[model samples]
Target: MIGFTLLIALVGAERIAELTVARRNRSWALSRGGVEYGRGHYPGIAAAHAGLLGGALLEAWLLDRPFIPALGWPMLGLAVLAQGLRWWCIATLGRRWNTRVIIVPDLPLVARGPYRRLRHPNYVAVVAEGIALPLVHTCWITALLFTIVNLGLLRTRIRIENTALRQAADTTPASP
Candidate 1:
């Protein structure tokens, strides 16, 4: 249960970072008349994430799982890594990156840092944390459920964001 609580705290901090940076980005985009899509699914995504923590706690308690201190410690380390990469993504994009798919035409595409390697490094962090954090205590159910639901969500989300990004690129002038 202690492990579970720490996991929740870690996730909570990630959310705080996203909200702080992403919200600012969102607001900046909004000021430029950017269009947003897929706001309706955000609540579902939040609920699914909350379920990840709940499921982890339930499995830890019902199964009498002995928390491996060694694994738990390392998992926290991975969680930190994921968080760092996620925020790096935000910082790289500055006001162009957002939690929501906000597309402002005539804006430049972000192509630095993690964005240079992958278009969606933030999502990479998300996938890593979803599986790695739950496995800290050997909670397979939490990891599995989170992966399944989040993958489905990401499939839809990625399509939408990619479309928006492509549109933004077509309308905006390329940087040298």
Candidate 2:
């Protein structure tokens, strides 16, 4: 139980750090005339993420889930890998990365780092973490529920992002 609590605390701290970085990046993007897409869904996304954290803790504590070493260890490893991938995405995008879908017009799409292989590598990390974090303590219900909801949310998010990217590409002036 104590270990689970510590895990939650660490995850919470990481979330705070991510939000700080997002805010900084947001400011940078906005200063450079970045236009945001999918503002209508931003609150839903935020609420769902908050719910994920809270639900994991509740399911683990209230249901008294056991941290099966076999499952927990592997899930922990996946969670760590997800975090690493997420940070790699952040580093790759640098000032362009944010929690929201803010795009600076006419900028070429980033194709470095993880983006070279996967267009949505950050979302991949998010999906992996969504599953791994809850399963670390055998909270299968939370893991499954979050994954389902997140997929639905990601559908809309990806659509908006793709549209924005297309618009940006269309508007970019061709160099001779």
Candidate 3:
């Protein structure tokens, strides 16, 4: 339980850092005429994430869940890996990365780092953390609930992002 609490605290701190980076990036992008899409779903997405964290803690405590050594160890490792991937995405995207779906017009798509291999590597990290974090403390219910809700949210998010990306690509002039 102590370990789980510490883990959650660390995750919370990591989220704060990500938000700091995201806010800076968002400001930089908006200053350069970046347009945001899918604002309608943003609130729900935010709620789901907040719920995941709170629900995990609540469920673990209320259910009196004990950390299963086998599952907990592997989930902890997976959570660490997810954080690494999340940072990699942020580093690769630089000022283009944000919590919201904001795209700067005429900028070519980033194709380096994890982006070279996967179109939505950041979401992969989100999914991984969503699952791994709760499971680390034997909070399977929280893990399953967040995964389902997040998937629904991602469906709309991806569609909006793809359309935005395509529109940006169309508007960008072909290089000589």
Candidate 4:
């Protein structure tokens, strides 16, 4: 349980680090005329993610969730892999990667790395990690709740991103 608690804490720290990177990326994009979309739902996204982190720990400890070695080991590996995928998305997008949907004007769509294969690979990581992380400690309640809320959030987020990207693409001049 102590180690599991530490693992949750580390995940929390990693989220904070991601926010720091997001903040920097947001600044860089906005400096170059990036337009932000769906600002209203950003708070909901943040709150839900924070709840996911907290709920996982609380449920595991309070509910006396058992760390089944079979489930825990595989889930831990998946969570780690998800983190790697998330970072790959970030590195692929460079300064354009942000937690918020901020699209810089006049830039062509990124068609490399994970983006080449999926329209939203980062969300794939998010979805995977959300479930896998909690299940690591058999926090099924957290896993289920977070996944339900996350799906709703992802729906709204993807719509806004697609609309924003579509608009940006329309205004950007075509290359000869």
Q: Could you say which candidate leads in lDDT? A: 4
Clashing pairs in 1: none
Candidate 3 lDDT over residue span 1-176, tens digit each: 97798889888888899889989999999999999988999999989988988999999999998899999999999999999999999999998999999989889999999999999999999999999999998999999999999999999999999999999889989988
Error of 4 at 16 (Å): 1.1
RMSD in angstroms, candidate 2? 0.8
Kindly provide the TM-score of model 4 when superposed on the true structure, using C-alpha atoms: 0.98
Model 2 scores a C-alpha lDDT of 0.92
Model 2: how far is 33 from its true place, Å?
1.0
TM-score of each model, in listed order: 0.87, 0.98, 0.98, 0.98
Q: Compose the digit string of candidate 1's lDDT tens values, residues 1-176.
A: 77576767767776777778878888888999899977877777778877887788788879866668888778767877988997888778888888788898887677789988898898999998888788788787888999999999999889888887777778777777
TM-score order of candidates, best first?
4, 3, 2, 1
How many backbone clashes does every candidate have?
0, 0, 0, 0
Q: Estimate, for each residue in 62-123, the C-alpha lDDT of model 4 and write its tens digit.
A: 99999999999999999999999999999999999999999999999999999999999999
Query: Model 4, residue 101: what's the lDDT?
Result: 99
